[model samples]
Target: MKKIFFTLVAMSAILVACEGKPSAATKTTEAEDSTVLVLFDGETFNGWRGYNKDHVPGKWTIEDGAIKINGGGAGEAQSAEGGDIIFDRKFKNFELELEWKVAKGSNSGIFYLAQEIEGKPIYISAPEYQILDNENHPDAKLGVNGNRQSASLYDMVAAVPQNSKPFGEWNTTKILVYKGTVVHYQNGEPVVEYHLWTPQWKELLDKSKFSAEKWPDAYELLINCGGENHEGYIGLQDHGDDVWFRNIKVKILD
Candidate 1:
């Protein structure tokens, strides 16, 4: 009986050696870190779709591992779907990370707290993280404390000026929202930061175009936590010109 037991133990040891434990590399790739948010993978469209609607137009295609707006793409408007792509899930306070490259003369922006008003672009309802070919686009040189360039709040607020990379190259942008503070960072540096509805911010809104157009919404910051909702969707802008995006991701904070 002792001899049989020894033989069985030896066999078990051999089996363990043959299989071993998962390698470090395998473990790293299999388990996604909760803090990391990867928006697009080259092969599929997951965690995304069109805004205020169910399907995305065909223009937003995946080519060469990037989400791009090909010429003559699809949209509800028939003008190559110049709408936004959004997270099916809403978030309150979180940080977003993404990469983009814009063709000369193209334009786009990321929008948040996205509310699709009965019939309007999401920009009318939510705040924007501006994207533009600053060197080529006409709107590139137009703001005082808001609007006019990349990372600005799209005509409502100006992002703090930092030299943007040339067109067709990858640019990294970070949008961090926690409580009443909203910040825009470019290439690992913060260019803009603003509290929702402080007197100064409201005054800026009061004097801006948003006052006349997005009037009530302009005052929304005055409400608690932008209407007591700390969570919303992350949207990509299809600025009707042409743009490209990849490595889109987000990390939610408690």
Candidate 2:
């Protein structure tokens, strides 16, 4: 009888202890929930707006659970109503994740650390993650050794392994920026990694089309990159080509 009573008491004590503390998995999930911010809620443009404008462009819409650009197929010579769009908030160091797919022969880009200069385009003040139909888009063949291909640092550094899905298939992308280091992930694989504000970065800028002689304004901005604040808005390009993005989220990193 005494043994039975002791066993019951011990079991009750164990249960109390377990109930008092969350499991490791539960703790991790809670931490993730707290740090993550849903850039798009998959329903409306709650935290998005046109770059340099107050509202989202009419060309951008939610379709089939994704933020899609209804392009005229003109390729950057898009209508006045269509342009790049950006998240309203600025992030300094973060891990951004999204799923994207492009239409046949389409061209688009994901911009980070982008500043809104009154007359300058988004790409002028930000680095771009190239999005394209590698099999059909002319850009896939341009740039040095596929630097202009999907997942590449647009016209600067090529995404190694070149593992972009074919047009119309969803591809997962992750952009991690912390301190001065930037890493691009494609389909769960880290494809490109580089550091900003370094001598190597300066050399890269000097050789790219953003060189001081070619585009002085862009060169000046690209040199400093994120400006004095080291933070900027996330933007999506409307390159007059149909593109779809969904599951956009970010986790601010310390």
Candidate 3:
């Protein structure tokens, strides 16, 4: 009886010692730490779909653990059926990170704060983070300064001293959208930062291509319907060039 009593006491002591310990998942989601979410499983299109489509586009496929699309050929137009793939849910404020690589002469983009609207392309409503083969793509030479270069906030801000790696090499990108402040990071460095819906932002938009009379609807989408709808899809562009992406994740902020 004494041996059994000692065993019970030992078990009770062990249980008491573990009463305040945290599990692995609890360690990952501490209140002081941001809540992380994996956007891609690296195995299938579990939570992704072609922008505005009911299915993953045929041209996009899961291979070697990355989302990939094969283009027409080197320097040829993208003939693939892939248009754009977007995370199905909308996010208001988040910090997102992903890895990407583009083939030579290729172009692609990452878009956020996108509100899907009928009769419009994603670019018509969302802002893009440009992805390009700077050495070869014609667009690399056309924007005011280098605002359209890879890792730039597409057409609005230039990422100084461009840090993109060479073609076929992997690059990491981080995007943070908190309330109205937005920041873009490339290759582990912050490249561009700005606030939305401010006077300076309005001025930037007024002077950019986005302000053309041809896109009054786009202007409205960016400025008018001004609530959580600003919280919209996260998208990957199909610039008709070959591109691959993986390791996509996001952390929500309070």
Candidate 4:
């Protein structure tokens, strides 16, 4: 009888100790309850449009659960006509995740802090997270030290390890921006990280194609860029090749 009584008391004590504590599953549920915006619904372009335009161009389409683009031509191709697309909403600091795949020889990019000038393309003033077929694309061989390859800061900084999967295979990318610091991840590995608007960034920009004398358009657009205003649209480049993107989502950080 005493043993039974003791057991009951111990069980009661345990229950009391756990009464107010949340379980792991409950914690996960609470975490998920936080605000997250779905940029691409996998079926329609409910929250995206061409830069400075009211609608996405004919070359961009929704197919097989992916936001696909297949008409723009490669390198210096008629960009003003096929131009890039931007998220309908602008974000200052946020974490974005998406899955993307490219056809052989395809080249494209994702841009952040992207502001659309009336007649300029997104890349003119924004920093790009390069998306390219390193094995086949010629631009992959043009930038200094792999800076133009997949997951790079596009001509300004190279992603270490250059960890891009082969063409036709989907690669997951996560980009996080908070308080002027940015990071890029490829296939779950962090490959690039940098602080924006700092002296180092300024130097990199000065040496990059954005400010190069040979690239007059790029140089002019970024000539006066600064951090006084950092919030802007998220963009996908229409680089005149077939590319696929899906599962696009973002969480704006406080």
TM-score of each: 0.77, 0.88, 0.82, 0.83
Tens digit of lDDT per residue, candidate 4, span 38-134?
A: 8888888998888888988778888999999875566433554576899987788778899999999999999987777886667877889999999
TM-score of 3: 0.82
Q: Please, what is the whole-model Cα lDDT of each candidate in the order they appear? A: 0.69, 0.88, 0.78, 0.80
In the range 1-254, model 1's lDDT, one tens digit per residue, is 34334544653354335454334454334236564667687667787788776777676888788888664333433453546778787777678888888888777888876655555666655678888888888788766653768988666566665557889988999887766567788887677776664676666576665664556654454333235465567788776667888877776544
lDDT-superior candidate, 1 or 3 = 3
lDDT of the structure predicted as candidate 1: 0.69
The reply for model 2, stretches above 4 Å from the true place, is 1-27, 30-32, 75-78
Instruction: Report the Cα lDDT for residue 65, model 2.
Output: 88
**Clash tally for model 2:** 0
Q: Give every collision pair in model 3.
A: 78-240
For candidate 1, the 10 contiguous residues with the lowest summed lDDT are: 21-30
Error of 3 at 77 (Å): 9.1
**What is candidate 3's lDDT per residue for 53-99, written digit by digit as tens?**
88888878887889887665433323335577889988887889999
- Give the Cα-based TM-score of candidate 2 against the true structure: 0.88
Candidate 4 Cα misplacement greater than 4 A, ranges: 1-34, 75-81, 212-227
Q: Best TM-score goes to which candidate?
A: 2
